[model samples]
Target: MGLIDHLKARLGPARGKVSDLAQQHGDKVQHGLDKAAKAVDEKTKGKYSNRIHTGTDKAKGAMDRLAHKDEPGTEGGGGSGGGDMFTPPRTPPPTS
Candidate 1:
C-alpha cells in the first residue's frame, strides 16, 4: 500500500475515537463557539457581525461533520470518497 493508505490504516481507530468524542460533546463545542462569537461581536460593536456569523456557522457545520463522520452507511463514513462533496442546500439560491 502507499504511504497515505498505510497512515490511514494506522490512524483509523484513533480517528474513530476522536469522532466519537466529538459526537458526544458536540453541544459543548458548539456552545463554546457561540460564546466566543458573541464576545468577538460585542467587542467589535457589531462591526463584523456578518463575518462572525459566517465563521460561526462554518464552525458548527464542521462540528456536525466531525460528529457524524463515523456512522455506518452515512455519508462521510470510512470508505467511499463521495461524502465530502455532497451536502443538501440549506437555502435556496438567490434569484437574479
Candidate 2:
C-alpha cells in the first residue's frame, strides 16, 4: 500500500472516534459557533451581521458534515467495506 493508504489504515480508528465525538457534540459545537458569531457581531455593532450569519451557517454545515462523515451510506459506507449510496439534500437560499 502507498503511504497515504498506510496512514489511513493506521488512523482509521482515530478518525472514527473523532467522527463519533463530532456527532455527539455537534449541537454544542454549533452553539459555540453561534455564540462566537454573536459576540463578534456585538463587537462590530451589527455592521457585519449578514456576513457573520452567513459564515456561521457555513461553519454549522461543515460541522454537520464532519459529524456525519462516518455515517452509513454517506458517500462511503460506515467502515464496513461496502459501498452505499447517499446524497445530501441541498439547502435553499434564504428569503429576504
Candidate 3:
C-alpha cells in the first residue's frame, strides 16, 4: 500500500475514537466554541463579527459532521452520512 493508505489504516481506529467522543460531547464542544468566538469578537470590538460568527458556525458544523449527527441511529437523524475529512470549496480563477 502507498504511504497515505498505510497512514490512514493506522489512524482509522483513532479517528473512530475521536468521533465517538465528539458524539457524546458535541453540545459542550459547541458551547465552548461559542464562548471562544464571543471572546474574540469582543476583543476585536466587533470589527470582525460577521467573519467570527461564520467561522464559529463552520466549526460547529464540522463537529456535528464528525459526530455523525446527520446519520441514522444518532440524534437528529436522516442523512446519507459522510465520514470523510473536510474538503474546502474551491475558488474560481480570476479574470484578467
Q: Could you say which candidate leads in TM-score?
A: 3
Off by over 4 Å in 2: 76-96
Which residues of candidate 3, in runs, are more than 4 Å off?
73-96
lDDT of each: 0.79, 0.76, 0.78
Candidate 1 TM-score over all chains jointly: 0.70
Deviation in Å, model 3, residue 43 alpha carbon: 0.7
Per-residue lDDT over 1-96 for candidate 1, one digit per residue giving the tens place of the 0 to 100 score = 699999999999998888898899999999999999999999999998987997788778777777877666656344344433355555754699
lDDT of 3 by residue, 6-93 (tens): 9999998998888899989999999999999999999999998987986787788788778884356754543435432344764654
Cα-based RMSD of the predictions, in order?
6.2, 7.3, 5.4
My TM-score estimates for the predictions, one after another, are 0.70, 0.65, 0.73
Candidate 2 weakest ten by summed lDDT? 79-88
In lDDT terms, which candidate is top? 1
Off by over 4 Å in 1: 76-96
Residues 1-96 of candidate 2: C-alpha lDDT, one tens digit per residue: 699999999999998888888889999999999999999999999998987987787677667777777666754445433222233454776799
The residue pairs in collision within model 2 are: none
